[model samples]
Target: MDNKIVVITGGSSGIGRALCNCFIDAGYKVAIASRSVEILEKVKSDLRSEGHEILTVKTDVRVDNDCKNLVDKVIEKYGKIDVFINNAGITWYESNEDGINIKKHKEIMDTNHFGTVQCTKYALPHLLKSKGSLVGVCSIAGEVGLPNRSAYSASKFAMNGFLNSLRVQYLNKGLQVLITYVGYTSTNIRKIVKDDSKSSHFPPGYGDAVKEKGMMTPAEAATHIFNGVKKRKRSVRSSAVGQLTVWLNKLFPRLNDKLAAKYYS
Candidate 1:
């Protein structure tokens, strides 16, 4: 195909799904991957557009084999990948004192941090060959640790560090690795969070707080991400709140900590 191609992991819903639709609307060949074949098919059906290619892959980013398969399948369909998005991630609430679910924390890391690592590792060769743009769907939690998102924060921090190094490593090779410090957006992630034990990592009833508040829509976040990738930006703060977190943590570390404690504690 003469047109460019984009591949998005975790593309069944939320920001990933929004990116798939956005790229489809922009006339790019889009490949959407997730572990759920049913949801993936639903997304493909909903987002299908004329004269644009949309392929779905059942991929579990936590497994290296699954990640490799996703990359290989995409390469098989599209000769080259023009843009690769490592958007597969999972998160649950955790705290040192009360909601400390150690196992759940590890699970979060497996999916959020290592999942991105696995996908990126497999996709790197193809990305290098195409000199494509690569984006990590990180969170504001990556910049500063929130009270109840220790694991999630750690994963995103890892993501930023990893991609930052990758960006420099590939800069001379004409490849782009960008990070998006996304703030809470209206998505089903909160609703779908795992509770591995009776004393769940999640608070009893705090699931949709991000959505209930006037959070940014996934579409808006995806638009910001797409634009950043286009401009070859090193990072894009998906929300002013996320930007505030980064700046405040930088300039007024103590005050930022106090505020976070007050809000989340």
Candidate 2:
């Protein structure tokens, strides 16, 4: 869709960055929003050098005003939004053995779940006007909880439910709501902790274990997202494992729980 505008949250790095490139290559006008102004400018400059023009907005999705301003800026720039991808999210890898870190849980929920809700609330009007798509870059954890990711899973589960409900609510309104279940990918999301003074609570050698297991690249995940949007697909899974996990959980939830525990452990 040449010149069709797509607004993405958390578009500075990782899958978000790759999504910018993918959409640009496909001839869409991409607008990205993130909390980091420096990273936003860098990504904008880098893309500008490649002859692709994009709009960047400094947005903290947890803030209602910021989310509203993000949509306002994109509409001001492009006249309309053809798609809005709620991709901004954070996770905590702490275990329940230490008791839930209520503070960290709130932070993750604010970023991942409430962030999606706020953005969607602001973007829905424009999306409805354009008969556009609303996409959530959710996770397999949303479908099946994993060990040591209680907060993250809860956030995604909330996101999944919210988006799914919107999908049905607007089914007769020519709106497309897509929920993408992303599997383990080679992204820095896991290693990042909300408090820079502390380190992630992942078990020792977790990085090495991830490396040994292998994961999808951000580009691969972006490609899947782009294709899903292009096709107006209701849902997509970034990895076959994620797809299987959703199905297995549907049929044999208890067995899937054991499998999830073993995989994460």
Against the true structure, whose TM-score is highest?
2
What is the TM-score (0 to 1) of candidate 1?
0.91
Return the clash pairs for model 1, or none.
none
Task: Please provide, for model 2 over 215-263, each residue's C-alpha lDDT reduced to its tens digit, 9 standing for 90 to 100.
Answer: 8888999999999999999998989877887899999999998887776
Give all TM-scores, in the order shown: 0.91, 0.93
Prediction 1 global C-alpha lDDT: 0.82
lDDT, candidate 2, at 216:
85
Off by over 4 Å in 2: 194-213
Question: How many backbone clashes does every candidate have?
Answer: 0, 0
Which candidate number would show the highest lDDT if scored against the true structure? 2
Look at candidate 2 and give me any clashing residue pairs: none
